[model samples]
Target: MTNEPIIPTRKLLLVCGCLLGLTALTVVAYYVDLGVFHTPVALGIAGVKAVLILLYFMQLRYSSGMTRAVIIVGLLWLGLLLAGTMDDALTRGWLNVGAP
Candidate 1:
């Protein structure tokens, strides 16, 4: 195994601070009411949070390119599956209330 330097405590604190700040931002964003863009904005913030966790908490930044590629592909595949499911759900006639 290669001799990799350990991450500094300060850096870890900084990342934690950033994650906390982003969490606060997400909470604030919820009450802002951007209408049609609300979901996209929330999703974008969540994506940033996920990346930070993946890179630092999961130590993916120090990993090989193949590992990163596999993760990206997996996330994309999951996204596609979710999107397809949402599409199908939206197209279905569930309640059968017939246009109130």
Candidate 2:
């Protein structure tokens, strides 16, 4: 049998409350204009929510070392994919091509 750590009901409720608050913040951020900071702010809040879900709901905090390593690797791979896509998009207009 595998041994797993059990979380308390109060902690779970707190996390749930935090997640709800963050969701509300995200919606509020959408209506407010921070110019170039909007996207980063939204993404930052999302990242925090993701971490909370991963650690508590998914039980990654109680998972084995290998499981955590795998999660990290997966995140790294996703980051690389996003970076590549952004690189291509941002550089697309650098060169001008004549209409054929």
Pick the TM-score winner: 2
The models' CA-based lDDT, in order, is 0.85, 0.92
Task: Check candidate 2 and list the clashing pairs.
Answer: none
The Cα error of candidate 1 at residue 52, in Å, is 0.7
TM-score, cand. 1:
0.77
* Per-model TM against the reference: 0.77, 0.84
lDDT of 2: 0.92
Error of 1 at 77 (Å): 1.6
List runs of model 2 lying over 4 Å from the truth: 95-100
Model 2 TM-score is 0.84
